[model samples]
Target: MKTYLIATLAMAASAVAQPQKAETPSPEPSRPQMRAEQPAAPKPSRGAFDAMLYVSVQDPSMEWWFNVPEGFAPHISEIKKIFHNQEFSLFPFADNAKVKEGKFSISYSISMKSPDGSLTELVRGAKYEGTKVADDIMVACPDVIDFKLDGRFPEGLYKFFISAKDGISGEISEYENHIRLAEWSAPVPFTGKKLVSDYVRAFSLQPSPEALYSIVFSDDFDLEQKGAPNSLNYTYLGFMKAAFKKNMFLISHIRDSFKSLSDLNRAKFILILAILGEKGIDASALSEPEKRYQEQIRAFKLPDPYGKWDPFLGAAQIDMLWGEFFADGTYRPVRRILNILSHAKEAAFADELAEKSRAPKTQAEWDRYMLGRLYKAALKTVAINARKYPLVEQYCAWALLHGDIPEVSYEVLSPMLEHIREMKSPSGGESGENPKVRMPRIDVESL
Candidate 1:
């Protein structure tokens, strides 16, 4: 009985020991093996984001930038004008945005759309708009779908849309751009077409080619042609101040530049002679004082004393070339050269020469006067042979389409023979007299 009890107690003890020992059964290799077979768990997706937004005129001379969530790269590609569905593709810049990590920097240059309404590929001096960098939170990062719009878009609806990719699931999440553009007064003043017309009307009384030429030569000139925002150049207020100064200068120099003030009063003398010469007036037709002047003119042939004037713009051309043609009177030599060109029988050749003969004058007055003469002479020459050459008339019409000037009568114009005669050569070298012009001074330090 004692032996039986001891054995039983030993068995109980063994069972108790087994329970307390905590059986570590060959440390299940299953868990480690399963872990080795499984792939990595994906990263978590970011939560929804919302931000502010706004839209404004885009400047072609600038690079625009936008900030977006890293996963929204696919959505940004959609925003591009040339969108292509591909992962990790670069976005095309619409405006002149120099994109660096989706950051923007702009350049100073004019850009205009071509005739077909496509953007000009290169920078120009006559079509750029002013640039502004927006540091506002909305402008900086517009990737959020719940973005609130700033500024009122009065004329049209302002819209935005966004899409993002789920990093872990590789699923796309679309967002309707909730931001709407609000219409707000621009910080910069707006100068419209009406203002420009008003300015032209107010100061057009005593015409100066300088004013007109300045308008055409402006760096932002192309915008004016396309009816773009005039504010792109400068404020109307700023323009008015400069115009006032130009107006004063034009008024002061009207007599010297527009009226007959240069050339020893020879231009006026020629004018009187041409008027008389057209009426077939001779030496005997003049009164006592006029006769003396006529005698001097006849002896001097003062219209073109140097023969250089005659060969290019001979006797007949000199007689009919309007005195107003040379507003400064010093450009008579150039006028004569142009007259010789007008006599060319081939209208195409004549126009080609005229296009090539751009005057080398920086002053608006000089350039305008020369261009005006060229325009007029070209028109008159075409009109002279209107019946035989219809294309000449069409060319003249095209030239007149873009400009306004006094109407000319073909009956009053000089004959072709006279035009030919004026294009003759003189005996010898002419006198050395430089016309008034501003020459560039070299900066020695630059060299």
Candidate 2:
């Protein structure tokens, strides 16, 4: 029980975030040549709709900020805005008719002033106008904007002043809007006592903001003199999407900061974070479908009445019959997939998916445990497979033992674990003998 758990969780998560972090963005290039680059881009015929990734991306002029697509920006009124929710990821889309053609410049300036001081020129004169294309409806691909705090932008109200001038029309649209940038998330050390991973899991996997405050109630721990969770210290989960990395980082920090923990709680706590870190929810690292699926999950609700959303993307692979979630997150799909995998002994798909889903990469010491977590995707299926595949059961049991939340673990798994036991013969398994699967004993030392 050496406290490598914190480091292991961080390492696993950082391993995924490292690539994006490695190329820490410097100033964006000024030219916006953006010309030759587009001609070579894959040509997909679709209406011109502007898309942008709103994460922590930087252009030459700005620190950590968002970028508008190079061309065909619709009128200020033309932008389609999706209001923030518990999911907090907003996709701003513009009509192709508003796409800017010819040479034009979009200048963005950001400034903030508080009672204590006046802040100006945090980023100014950041101009983007490139990729000359027709003004018609043939634009493909969504423009991306990365909105984030690189720890520089201060909290409080600030104006994001945007001015667009047509190089040909000699007409300009000027508008300025205020945005509140809160302090980005960071892990907090336990000021007094350590809480188990249950607190961490509850906070991170909160279905709604209303559910989180109690997880870290002041009555439970010393949260400064204020003795309560406050905006100054912690952010709402609604902001978790854009700041997901920061959120997880903060959670890991909490996990690592434990002043004390029982052996059992520590083991369970590490497993919860390790699995999530290994299986990231990074939008940058997901397919379009994956991005949508995750969106629904983050919101804890998927409105798929029209059948427009899918909850399983890469994990389902070619055969979605075994996928994990429905748009509404019912476990029917989980059950269906498990039944198929458990019965489809002629095919290797189930095992393959289980193996592939297990820590994409991990030290050998914890690989089996990771695999157990992975098999949790089809927990019921895992239970069935466990009778004949002891290793599969071991992994599944380990995964189901420590859920993303306590309720999830106990409510869903407690019965399942008991059912699994009931399926076995009194001696051990179905045939009064333990299945002799040759998987190595779980070596958690590396974990």
Give the winner by TM-score. 2
| TM-score of each predicted structure versus truth | 0.15, 0.28
Superposition error at 409 for model 1 (Å):
15
Measured with C-alpha atoms, the lDDT of residue 304 in candidate 1 is 32
Worst 10 residues of 1 by lDDT: 1-10
- The segments of candidate 2 whose C-alpha lies over 4 angstroms from its true place after superposition are 1-117, 130-155, 181-246, 256-268, 276-447
Residue 132 in candidate 2, Cα distance off native in Å: 6.8
RMSD of 2: 22.4
**Native-referenced Cα lDDT, model 2:** 0.29
- Candidate 1 stretches with Cα past 4 Å from truth are 1-195, 201-343, 348-447
The model with the greatest lDDT is 2
Where is the poorest 10-residue window by lDDT in model 2? 5-14
lDDT of 1 by residue, 161-250 (tens): 233322222333232211122222212211455543443433322233244334322333222222212212212222322233323322
